[model samples]
Target chain A: TQLLEQSPQFLSIQEGENLTVYCNSSSVFSSLQWYRQEPGEGPVLLVTVVTGGEVKKLKRLTFQFGDARKDSSLHITAAQPGDTGLYLCAGVGHSGGSNYKLTFGKGTLLTVNP
Target chain B: EPEVTQTPSHQVTQMGQEVILRCVPISNHLYFYWYRQILGQKVEFLVSFYNNEISEKSEIFDDQFSVERPDGSNFTLKIRSTKLEDSAMYFCASSDQGPYGYGYTFGSGTRLTVV
Candidate 1:
C-alpha cells in the first residue's frame, strides 16, 4: 500500500494568516485529491490534481501536485475562521492492477482563530 | 446538489451482535464505497462496489464484514459480529465514474459504537 505522510499535524493561526500543509509519499500516484472534514461530518472533496506539476486554485486555497506525483501541498492565503477543519490528502493508483482504493494521509488539523 | 445519504447518525450495539449500516448513494452514480475512521485517525477504505460487485476491499474488511447493494439506490454494510475495535465513523461514498475519475461524493457518515 502507498503511504502518504502529512506534516504539521496541528496548526493554530490567527485569522488572515497564511499557512501551507504538506503531504508527501515515496510512491507515485495517478491522481491526488484534497478534502476538508469538519467535526462529525464526512470529508468534503476540495480539489483533485491529476497531471504532474499541476496547480489548481479554489478562491484563497491553492493546491499543487509535485512533478514526481509523489507529493502534494495545500496553501491557504489569508485563512479565515471558516477554513478551520481537518485537511486530508488522498491518492489513487492502479499500478500493476494491485491497488485501487483511495489511500489517505493522516490529516492536518488547521484552526484559524477569529 | 445531489448527495449521498446515510441513516442512523449514531448506533450503539453490544459486542457479537449483528449490525447493519445503510447508505443511499447519488441517483446516477455507478460506483459505491465504504470507508471507516477511528477517532483521530486517517480514513481507511473498507470496500468498493461497482456493477453490483465488489471491485476492491482492504485487509481490514475481513470475514466479519460484508457489503451489498440490495436495490438500485441503497448500499449497505453488515458486520456479522461486532467487536469493540469496530467503533468508528463509517462513511459511504459514490462516484459516477471509476477509480480514475474524480466526481466522488461522501455521506455525512454513521457513527458505530460497539460495547
Candidate 2:
C-alpha cells in the first residue's frame, strides 16, 4: 500500500506567522494535489503539481513538489485567520487506469489565531 | 463554477439496513469518484467510475458495497448492510480529466450515521 506521511498533524499559530506542512511518501507519484477542507464540507482543491521540483503559488500560499516526485509541501506566508483549515495532500500514481485514483495523507489541521 | 452535488446532507440508519448515497457529477465531467472520511481520519478513496462502469476500487469496497451510474447524470453508492464502522462523511467528486488531467471537484458530503 502506498502511504503518505504528513508532518505537524496540528498547528496553532498567531496570525501573520508563516508555516510549512510536509507530505512524504516512499513511492513515486505522477502528480500531487493540495486541498483545504472546512468543517461541514468536503475538501476544496488548492493546487495540482505535476512535475518534480515544480513550485506554484496561489496568492499567499505556495506549493512545492519534491525533485523525486515522492513528496510535496505547502507553505503559507503571513497567514491570516482565514487560512485556518485542514490541509490535505493526495497523490496519483502512474499505473492506475483511472489516472485520478488518489492516495491521501492524514492531513494537517491548522489554526491561525487573529 | 461547476460543482458536484450530493443529496441528504445527513443520514441515520439502523445496522443491517440498506442506504444509498446519491451524487450528481458535473455535466461535462467524464470521471466520477466516491470517497469517505472517518471522523479524524484521512479522506479515503472508495471507488472510481468512468464510462458507466467501475474502473477501480479500494479494498474497503467489499461485497456489501456497490456503485452504479443509474442514469446519465447520477452516480449512486449503495451500502447493502450498514455497520457501525460505516458511519462517516461520504463525499462525491467529479473531474473533467482523469487524476492526471486536473484536480477534482468534491461535494459538501453526506454524513452517514449507522446505529
Candidate 3:
C-alpha cells in the first residue's frame, strides 16, 4: 500500500509565527494536493503541485513538491487564527485506465493563537 | 463556485440496518467518488464511478457497500448492513475531467453513527 507520512502531527503557534508541514511517501505520484478542513466541514482544496520540484504560493501559504515526486511541504508565513485547521496532503495516482485515486496523509492539526 | 452537495448532515442508525447517503455532484462533472474518514483516522477512498459503472473500488468496498447514480445529478451510496466499524464521515466528490485533470470537489460529508 502507498502511504503518505506527515510530520509534526500537531502544532501550536502565536500569531505572526511561521510553520511548515511535511508530507513524505515511498511511492511516486503524478500529482499532490493540499487541503485545509475546518470542524464539521469537509476538506477544502488549497493547492495542487504536479511537477517535481515545483513551488506554488498562495498568499501566505507556500507549497512545494519534491524532486522525486515522493514528498511535499507546506509553509505558512505570518500565521493567523484564521489559518488554524487540519491540513492534509493527498497524493494522486492512476489506479488503472482513466481511474485515479487520492491517498491522504493523517494530516497536521495547526492552531494559531492571536 | 460550484459545490458538491450531500444530504442528511448526520445520521444515527441501529446495527444491521440499511442506510443510504445521497449526494448531488457538480452539474458538469463526469467522474464521481466516495470516501470515508473514521474519527481520528485518515481519509480513505472507497469507490469511483464513471459511465454509469464502477471504475475502481478499494477492498473496503465489500458486498455490503454499493453505489448508484440514480438520476442525472444524484449519486447515492447504500450500505446494506451497517457495522459498528462502518461509522464514519462519508464524503462524496466529483471531478470534471479526472483527478489529473482537475482535483476532486468534495461535499460537506455525512456523519454516520451506527449504534
Candidate 4:
C-alpha cells in the first residue's frame, strides 16, 4: 500500500470559492511539506510544517499540521484561477541520519475556474 | 537562490537502448537525489547520492539503474537498458545542511519517453 494518502483526488471551484485538500497517513512524520506543480513543470515548494498543531499562512493559502503529525490540510480562501495546479503533500520520515527521505502522497488535482 | 538543473529536457529512445540522464546539483548542497513520476502518478524517489556514493534507494532502483558523479559538478543516472515502462519525468533535487526547515529544490525534470 502507498505510504501516504491524499483525499479528494480532484477538486474544481470557481474563482472566489473556497476549497480544502487533505493528506493522511498511519505513521508519524518528522515534517510535512505542501507543493504545487503546473503541467509540464516540477513541483514548487509551498509550505513546510514541522511542529505538531502548527499552522502557516501564505497569502490566501493556509496549511496545518495534525497534532499526531500523521495528517495535514491545505485550505485556500477565495481561490483564484491562478491557484489551478496539482497539489501534493510530502512527509519527511525520520529513519536516521538527518532523514532526508520524503514520501509523497498521490496528489490532488485542483482547478480554479474564473 | 541556487537551483538544481537537469539536462536533455526531453529524451526519446527506443526500448532496450542505453540512456543517461544528467543533472547538476546546487554547488553548496550536500545531498543529491533522483526521483521520477509516471504520468498521473505520484513522484517517487529513485535513489540518493552523497559523499561520492549512494546513501539510499527505493526498490524501483533496480540493477539496471546506476548513478555516478563523473566530476565535481555533475551527477548522472544511467539506465543500462531502458524499457517502455521507464518513460517518466525524472527530477534531481538538492538540499543544504539544514535538510529540514527548508524543503528540497528540484530541477525542471527530464521527460524520458521510451518507444
Candidate 5:
C-alpha cells in the first residue's frame, strides 16, 4: 500500500503571501492529483499530474510531480482569502481494467486571512 | 458543472441500529466509491463499486458494512449495526471511467454520528 504523508497539517497566512504544501510517499504511483475541499462540500479536483517531473499550472496555483513519482507539491502564489481550504493529494494506479482507488494524504488546511 | 449529490446531510443512530447512506453519481459515470474521514484524520477508502458489485474494499469495510445500487441512479451504503466508531464523514464519489486512472469527483459528504 502506498502511504502519502502531507506536511503542515495546519497553516495560517495573510492574504498576498505565498505558500507551498508537500506530499511525500515511499511508493511510486502512476498518477497524482490535487483537490481543494471546503467545509460541508466534497473535495473538488484541482489538477492531475501523470509524467515524472511534470508541472502544471492553474492561475495562482502551480503543481509539480517529482521525477521519482513518489512525491508532489502545490505552490500558491499571492494566496488570497478565496484560497483558504483543505488541500489534499491523491495517488492512483491500476491493473487490467480495475481502477485502483487513490491513496490520499492527510491534507493541509490553509487559511489565508483577509 | 455536474456534481454528485447525497441525501440526509447528517444521520444519527444508536449503536445497534441499521443505517443506510445514499448517493447520486454523475449521469454517465461508470465507477462509484465510498470513503470516510474521521475528524482530524486522512481520508480512507471504504469500497469501490463497478459492474454492479464491489470491486475493492478496505479492511475497515468489514462484515458490518454493505453497498447496493438498487436502481439506476442511487448508490447506498448500509451498516448492519452501527458502532460509536462509525461516526465520521462519509463521502460518495463517481468517475466517468475509473478515475481515468486519474482523479475522482466526490460528493458533499454525509455526516454519521453513532451514539
Candidate 6:
C-alpha cells in the first residue's frame, strides 16, 4: 500500500510565526495536492504540484515537491489565526485503466494563536 | 465558484439500519468519488464512478455499500446494513477531468453516527 507520512501531527504557534510541514512517501506519484480542512467539513484544495522539484506560492503559503516526486512540503510565512486548520497532503497515482486514486497523509493540524 | 452539494449534514441511525447519503456534484464534472474519514483518522477512498459505472473501488467498499447516479446530476451512496464501524464523515467529490485534470472539488460532507 502507498502511504504518505506527515510529520508534526500537531502544531501551535503565535501570530506572525513561521512553520513548515513535511509529507513523504516511498511510492512515486503523478501529482501531489495540498488541502486545508475545517472541523465538520470536507477538505478544500489549496494547491497541486505536478512536476518534480517544482515550487508554487500562494500568498504566505509556499509549497514544494521533491525531485523524485516522493515528497512534498508546505511552508507558511507569518502565519495568522486565519491560517489555522488541518493541512493534508495527498498523492495521486494511477489505479488501473483510467482511474486514479488519491492517497492522503494523516495531516498536520495547525493552530495559530494571536 | 461551483460547489458539490450533499444532503443531511448530519445523520444518526441504529445499527443494521439502511441509510442512503445523497450528493450533487458540480454540473460540468465527469468523475465522481466517495470517501470517508473516521474520527482522528486520515481520509480514505471508497469508490470512484464514471460513465454510469464504477471505475474503481477500494477493499473497504464491500457488498453492503453501493453508489448510483440515478438522475443526470444526483449521486447517491446506499449502505444496506450499517454497523457501528460505519460511523464516520462521508465526503462526495468530483473532477472535471480525472485527478490529473483539474483536481477534485469535495462536498461539506455528511457526518454519520451509527448507534
User: Which candidate model has the greater DockQ, 4 or 5?
Assistant: 5
The lowest-lDDT stretch of 10 consecutive residues in candidate 5 chain A is A93-102
Taking the tens digit of each residue's C-alpha lDDT, what string does model 3 give over B1-115? 9999999999999999999999999999999999999999999999999999999899999999999999899999999989999999999999886856365899999999999
User: Per-residue lDDT tens digits of candidate 3, residues A63-105?
Assistant: 9999998899999999999999999998888332233678899
- Global CA lDDT computed for model 2: 0.91
Candidate 4, after superposition: displacement of residue B104 in Å?
A: 0.4
- Candidate 5 at residue B49, lDDT? 92
Residue-wise C-alpha lDDT for candidate 6, range B1-115, written one tens digit per residue: 9999998899999999999999999999999999999999999999999999999999999999999999999999999889999999999999986855356999999999999
lDDT of 4 by residue, B1-115 (tens): 7788999999999999999999999898878889999998999989888898998899999999999999999999999789999999998888776455364888999999999
Candidate 6, residues A1-114, lDDT tens digits: the string is: 438999889999999999999999887878889999999999999998988999999999999999998899999999999999999998888332233667789999999999
Model 5: DockQ score: 0.67
TM-score of each: 0.96, 0.96, 0.96, 0.95, 0.94, 0.96
Off by over 4 Å in 6: A94-99
Model 5 TM-score on a 0 to 1 scale = 0.94
List candidate 3 segments past 4 Å from native. Answer: A94-99
Clash totals, every prediction: 0, 2, 0, 0, 0, 0
Q: Model 4's CAPRI class? A: medium
Model 2: runs farther than 4 Å from truth? A94-98
**Candidate 4 lDDT by residue in tens digits, A1-114:** 777899899998899999999999888888899999988888888998999999999999999999988899999999999999999998887443336767899899999999
Model 4 misplaced regions, further than 4 Å? A94-98, B98-101
Which clashing pairs does model 6 show? none
CA displacement after TM-score superposition, residue A6 of candidate 1 (Å): 0.5
| DockQ-sorted candidate list, best first | 2, 6, 5, 3, 1, 4
- TM-score (0 to 1) of chain B, per candidate? 0.97, 0.97, 0.97, 0.95, 0.95, 0.97
Indicate the DockQ of the complex predicted as candidate 2. Answer: 0.77
Candidate 3 has a DockQ of 0.67
Q: List the DockQ of the predictions in order.
A: 0.66, 0.77, 0.67, 0.64, 0.67, 0.68
